[model samples]
Target chain A: MSSFVLFTLTGLGLAGLYFLLASGLSLIFGLMSVLNLAHGAFFAAGGYTAWFVMDALDSVPIGLRFIVALLAAGLVGASAGAVIERVLVRRLYGQHVEQILLTIGLGMAAVALMGGWFSYDPRLLTQPDWFGDTTEIAGANVPNNRLLILGVAILFFIGLMTFLKRTRHGLIIRAGVENPSMVRALGIDVSRSFTIVFALGGLLAGVGGALGTVYFNGISPSLGTTQLIFAFIVVVIGGLGSIPGTALASVLVALTQIYVNNYLTSGLGSISVVVLLAGVLLVRPQGLLGKAAP
Target chain B: MKRSSIFLFVVAAGLAVLPFVPIEVPLLFSGPFDTPGTLQVLSVALVLAGLAMSYDMIFGYTGLLSFGHALPFALGVYGTNLLMLEASIPYVLAAAITLGGVIVVSLVLGSVALRTSGVAFAMVTLAFAEAFSILVISDPLRFLGGEEGISLASEQVPDMFRRVVNTRNIYWLALAFTVFTFVVARVVVSSRAGRVFEAIRENEPRVEMMGLAPFPYKLASFTISSGLAALGGTVYLLAVRGANIGTTSADFTLSILVMVVLGGAGKLWGAAIGGFIYGILNLRLSTVATSNAIDNLPEWLSGPLSEPLFVLGVLFVILVMYAPGGLSSLATKPSFGRATRRS
Candidate 1:
């Protein structure tokens, strides 16, 4: 029972990162149709940014330093996302396929640049003392950081839900996903919302990266990329553009991975996740929450 | 056209006779042109050139953007290497078996992945490739080789292709493969099925309206292209002398896309040249990165420049945004920057 509880909680922690990255990716692909291959790069940048900021905050209290680092990472991600959209992605505006190619190039370059600045070697980040402690829950010693991640993810999910439901920009984004031209016909300029959606995604991924660095105990140049593949799986398994679907699928995929990896052989977990993806595709090609193809 | 064919023949002839030449090019080669070092680099170039052209069949001609092209290539290298080293199969038989395996594997994966169209198709294929990659890297079964892939057994390799001195023979095989792929791609592109592929790319609904099932044609393109990539994989193992985890990576698939797009997607020769140059540049740039000229520059400017992927990646982005037609179009014609997707 202790092991099961530990596994479930830890699994939920991992799901937090996937949710952050996949939610952003789904929103971008939903409204813009750009896969944003560079989304991983943004995640990496956030990791690096938080790492650097916290590393330099020798004067600050450990707890306070982490809060500052996390916010900085999110800020850096948002700025970069907005800039990429305004400068590079906006130029190829209606050419969604071309946008994919462009993002691929950007992703490659950004990751390479990160690798160059920081060596391929993994760098362990500085975390607070309490974060290193374990919290006993139901006789299971759960890492405090794992609980922190789960808490953050839940808060972000509620925040995302609220923003999407309450805001006018959210309405425009949702409508854009249904039909861009129809939204435009109603005299709404989704062009501005495009940048907002991109930034919003970057903010979530960036924040996730910071927490990922904390969860994994270190950050490497390739960290974002390895995680990105799983995030893509979650996004596809959940319906693209559906926030609630993304949230639900993240938990399912993460739990399955953790449970299998713990109970079964080491590698079967990854293979099974893929098998799960294939099974889903075979049964419902449009995805579980996605509507039929237009 | 006649003049261009003659020019092509001249270039092909020059490349074939390169092994016998004793002369050296200064910075690019560490030794004479025919030496093993130069030949290995040239051989890799030829192998990738062939691989790029094969990718073009599905991506450029059939207009399917597959992120899992690396799967067949990785299988080709890993399968042959696994058979020879672990199972003790001879090189000749192993390669033949692997090629057969590639055909079946690609066919099955293609049919399932092709069920979804466009971006969904790309993601599903990627998931499959990533799964295979994890299998190879993690080594669920010990024969797959965890993390570090296996090396070739000298005894299993035939007498003609062993040791560093025999690099020339491998180079010749790569050349043969490239020429074979070029011919096959050209022949198929001009054939009836090829027309259907282009039509499907132009407009899938229209192609369906024309009483042709696009599924079979798309599947055919996927199989043929992956078969050639697998064949190149066998040759790649011979040239590089081992199968590591890098070839199976999604990044490797992206590089293939870069090569095809950089050269000119629809044009076979464009992909060949683009991949060939990319190989040389990829190898040479590593050498250049450590040079005094690069190291002397300010860290701010030189850091990103030192990474080879940064250069090629930026080049890819610039090309996509400004010149969608690629290098071939500069000579043949210009295309307004638009990624090839059905209207």
Candidate 2:
């Protein structure tokens, strides 16, 4: 029973990481048809930036250092996202396939550059002593990192929801999603909103990456890619553009993976998640929460 | 024959007779063209060209951007290896059996995956392939070697493929396979079903409106492409004499997509060209990475220049941006490629 509690919390932590990626992927795809294959690269950028900052700040206070690292990662990722959009994606506007291909190339190139710079070796991110400790919940000793990551993700989720509901840019993004041409017909430039979405997506993925280092225990060149696969499954099963759907699916996938691995065979967890995806896709092609395709 | 076909035949003939020629190319090769080292590289390149052509059948022509295509190819590799080692079967019989398995799996997966369209289809296929990759790496039964993978038993291989010394025979086999696939793809691309595939790619709803079922055609393309990929995998296993988990990766499928696009999609020969160039570059670029010229560069610049994948990835980006028409498009006009002209 205690093990089950640990598993659930760990699963929630994993779900938080997935949400960070899926939210961005879902929104970007919802507004623009682009799949953003380079999203994992954005995540990696955040992770590496966090790792770098954390390592370089040995003289700084430990608690504040990680905070600074996390913020730097988000900022770097946001900038990178905005730049990639303006340079590569903006040129291929409306050419969905070409845009996707361009991102693929960019993704490949960026990951390889990271590998070249840092190699594939896993690097441990330094955290405060509290991160390593655990808190008891109902007789279960749950790791503090898990709770921390989950808390951070939840905060981000609420913040994102608020932004989406309250801000003018968010309103523009939502309206643009429904009908880009209609929004254009209303004399509002949707292109600026595209840049904002990219930046927002980058920020989420970046923060996720830093938090993911805590979740996964280390950072590697291929780290983003391995997690990206599960995130893709989450996005697809959650339905393309729905934030709430992405959040729900992330929880479903992470919990299923954790429980199945503990109760059943170990590696079957990932396979079962894929199985879940296949089942969902077969039943509802648009996904559980996604609207039916026009 | 048409001028291009005649030229292609002459080139094929020259390649066929290349084994007997002891001539050397200056910059491209470290040894004579027919040497085992060179033949080995050429064989892999030729096999990739063939593989790329096979991928074109579905992705380029039929408009299916499947991310699980590696599964069929990986099946051919592991199935043949396991059959040869565990069952004590000969290579040919094992290969044939694997081909049968590939057909069945592709048919089953295709029917299900084809149910969705656009990005959904890509995800479904990717999911299936990832499952396969996971299963292979997991190895519950312990037959499939985990990450390092399994190799074929030496005694089980045919005489002509027994050792590195027999690389010439394998190279010849690769050349023959490439030609066979190219010819098959050419014939199929111009056939009635092929016309239907292009039509589906252009506009599926319109094709459906014409009272024809798109599912069957898509499935047919899927199966055929799978069969070709499986054959390439068999050739690959023979070349490297082993199968590993990397072959089952989504990265492999993406590379195939890159090859198809880099050459010019919907153009069969263009895909082969793309595949061959990428294969050669992939194998040979490591030499460039370690070369003196690149070593002389600044540390920041030289570091990335040392990685072959980095160079290839950047090249992929530049080409996508500037030369979206691909290598073939830069050479000659695809006069009849009206169906492929969209961005």
Candidate 3:
């Protein structure tokens, strides 16, 4: 029972990272109708940036360093995303194939740059002293870092939901997702909205990557490709442009992956998740929470 | 002869004589190709051309953006290798079996993948490919040989594919296979079903409203495309004398896509041209990067720049941004003729 609880917590912690990664992808797809394949590059950039910051600020307080690293990651990711959107994504509106090719090319460039800059060796992010400690929860010994990640994920989920539901900008984004032409007709400047959404998505991915680096104890240039595939699966399974759907789908995928890895072989875990993605896509093309296209 | 047939004949004639042609590169442009290297690169290019044309069949003609194309191609390679090496099957029978397996796998994958359209379809195919790759690398059956992959000796294959004994045989085989693939692709694109594929691409709903079932046509195109891709893989294995995990990787799939797009999608000849350009560029660029040609640069700057894939990535981005229509468009533009007509 304790092991079960422990596994479940581990699954939820992983699900939190997936949620952060997929939410941005889902949001961008919903608002801009652009499947930003380079979103994984943003995640990778965030991880690498966080690692650099942590190394540079080694003399600072551990907690302070952690916060600074995360913020830096988010900022760097957002700026990269903004640049990509302004320069490339803006011109390829409604051209899915072009967008896909462009983003994929950009992604390859980003990964290559990372490899060139950082070398191929994986780097470890130093965890804070408090984060390193373990905590007892419901008779199960759990790592405090896992609990912290879970807390952060929940907060992010609530914050994103509130932002989307309550803020005018969020309302505009939702409106744009539903009907871009209608929003444009109302003088919302859909292009600007797209840029903002893209930045925000990048920020989320960055934060997720930073957190993931600490959790996984390492970061590498190849992280982007692996995480990108997972994000794709999550977004597809959850539904294309649905935030709530993404959250649900992330939990489902993460839990399944964790359970399979723990109980079965690690290789089977990846296979199972892929199978799950195929099954979900076949059964519900629109995804669990996504609305059908008109 | 008809114009198209004449064009085909010219292409075949050029390919037939290409291996015998002595390529002389100036000192400034000298990198990898001497003579044998050029032939080897040309043979690989021919195989890739076939692969790229197959990709064009689905993505360009059928309007299906499948990300798991490498699956069928790799399956063909591994299937042929396994049948010949392990099962001790004859070359013809093994190839036939591999083709059969490819068709069955394509039918199964296409059925599930075609349930979704657009982005969902791409993801679903990717998922299946990832699963297949993982399984192959994991090698639970032990036949896959894990990361070591599988290699076949000259004795394992038929007389024609014995690269060790006679390298030119494999080269000719690849060239023949490439031409065959192009002809088949050309026929399909000009056939009645090909018209339906284009119609579906332009507007699926309208075609559906017209009482034409797009699903069957798509499946047929996908199956045919997979078969061709498998054939390319067979040629690749025979020429290279091996199959590895990289054959089924996402990178390989993306590379095939890049070749198709760079040649201009929906054009069979364009894909072939694009494949040749990409293959040649990749080989030459990598050779240049590693050579002492850029030794003047600082270590930090030269280290990354020396990698061919990085250069390719930058080129890919630039090409997509500036010339999304690919190299084929440049050749077919008729800009000079248009200017003269305007004058």
Candidate 4:
């Protein structure tokens, strides 16, 4: 019973991070039709920013530190996204390969620059005093950080769903994804919409990264590559341009990963995940909730 | 003035004489003294070049962006290692087994990965490769030798020729492989079937409308490309003196698609040149930079970006900004950069 609860909590916590990372990638692809490989870099950057902020303000209260770090990461993500969208991504719209290459390049540069700024050794964000302490929940010993992650994930899903469904910008985003050419033709300034989407996506990715530092206990230069691969896998499994699908798939993948890790040998566990993914593709080429091709 | 014949003659002469030159200075233009070390380097280069060339068979010819081409490479290397260590098989038999193994694996994996196109295909392949890497790296009965990796005794080359393999002979072996691959790839590309591959690249729907099943073509290419990639892995193992689970095969960047793009995907020569440049940059240039002192640069700038991820970024940037069609365009002196006005 304890093992089951532990596995479930772990899965949920990881799913939150996955949703944070993959949501941005999915939204970007939906709006731009381009795969931005560097989305993972934003996640890494956010984590680093958070870590830096906390270190610089070493004496601050843990609650204020968390808030300040989260805000810093979000702002950095948004500013970087806006600048990148205007200067680079705008020219490479519709060119999927170029976009992948460019983002991958940017990701690499970010990692290298990070290594230069912060040594190769990994850095971790400290958990708040309230969250650092462990708790026994439903007969299972759970880390407060894990609980925080789950709460954040749930909150993010609710907030994102609400924003997309109830807001004017959200409606514009939906319309853009459905018929981008039409949206542009209608003089809705689709470029402006794209910039906003990119920034929002980056913000989410940043927050995910910041949160991830608490879960993983650290972030490294190479972490971006690993996270990038994981995020890409989640995006593929969930179906592009579908937030609901991303959320569900994130949980599914996390659950499967945790279950496999616990139940099977590590080698077989990985193979099983791949096999499961392959099975999914063979059954549903467009993903579980993906729109059927015309 | 037979241009083709002259080109062949020049290539043959360069390969034949390149090893006799002094060992201290790497030949700028292929003369004597291209020792066993150089030959080993060349062999590894040819192997990678062959893999890249075959990758072009799918990626370049079919317009499929598969980030998972490394799957076949892993299958080939690990399969050959198993054959070599478990069966105590000779190199000749082991090579054939590895090739066959990769073909089967590719067909099975491709059936699943090839179901989708564009980004979906790329994602699925990448996922599979990741999974495969994890499987090999994870400790399971030490079959993949786990983290320690498996080592081979030696190749089954004739005893007399073994001496020739020092550095120069290895270069010859590499050259022979490169030449053989170049010839085979060119012949395949020039065939009627090659035209079908090209058509698939241009428009799959149009080709299907003409009553051709694209799956078979893709499967065939996947198998053939995989077979060649396995052969590349085999050569790489021999050159490196052993195989490790995490080194190249498990590293997410094993089957470098960017190099293929940088070199020119469809062109065999492009693959060769791409591998050659990569080798030089990785082995010679990195070594020099690491060893030599840089004037007035910060200490951080001087460190080796030995991590594959670091170089990949730079390579991606160069490929994206400068040569979309690859380095083959540079070789052909094509007017590429002139057209993109970047509004």
User: Each predicted model: what fraction of the native A–B Cα contacts (within 8 Å) does it retain?
Assistant: 0.68, 0.56, 0.50, 0.62
Docking class of 4: medium
Please list all clashing residue pairs in model 3, or write none if there are none: none
User: Candidate 3 — what's its lDDT?
Assistant: 0.83
Give lDDT: candidate 4, residue B6. Answer: 78
- lDDT score, candidate 1: 0.88
For model 3, the DockQ equals 0.49
- In the range A137-239, model 4's lDDT, one tens digit per residue, is 7888887888888898888889888988999888888888788889888878878878888898888888888888888888886575677777777787788
Q: Each candidate's iRMS in angstroms?
A: 1.3, 1.4, 5.0, 3.9
All models: lDDT?
Answer: 0.88, 0.87, 0.83, 0.73
User: Tens-digit lDDT track for model 1 on B20-47?
Assistant: 9999887777788889999999999999
Q: On a 0 to 1 TM-score scale, where does candidate 1 land against the true structure? A: 0.97
Query: Candidate 3 docking category?
Result: medium
lDDT of 3 by residue, A44-137 (tens): 9999999999899989988999899999999998998888899888887767678888888788777777887788789988878787777887
For residue A211, model 1's alpha carbon misses the true position, in angstroms, by 0.8
Locate the minimum summed-lDDT window of 10 residues in model 4 chain B.
Answer: B334-343
The per-residue C-alpha lDDT of model 4 at residue A146 equals 83
List candidate 4 stretches off by more than 4 Å.
A116-120, A129-132, B1-9, B23-39, B155-165, B246-255, B292-295, B303-312, B333-343
lDDT of 2 by residue, B1-343 (tens): 8997998799789888887789987646667977898888889889889999999899889888887888888998898888989998999899899999999999988888888888878878888888888888888778889998898666778999977888999988898889988888888878999999999988899999999999999999999999988988888888877897888987787888888888877788889999998888888887857766888888778777777778888888888887776788888865556323554
How far off is residue B37 in model 4, in Å?
4.6
Against the true structure, whose lDDT is highest?
Answer: 1
Compute the lDDT of residue A172 as modeled in candidate 3. 92
Q: All candidates' TM-scores?
A: 0.97, 0.98, 0.94, 0.91
Residues A1-294 of candidate 2: C-alpha lDDT, one tens digit per residue: 899999999999999999998899899999987888899988998999999999998999989999999999999889998999998899888877778788888888788888878887888999899998999998899999999999998998999889888999999988887888899999999999999999999999999999998788888877787788899999989999888899999999999999999899998999999989988988998888998888
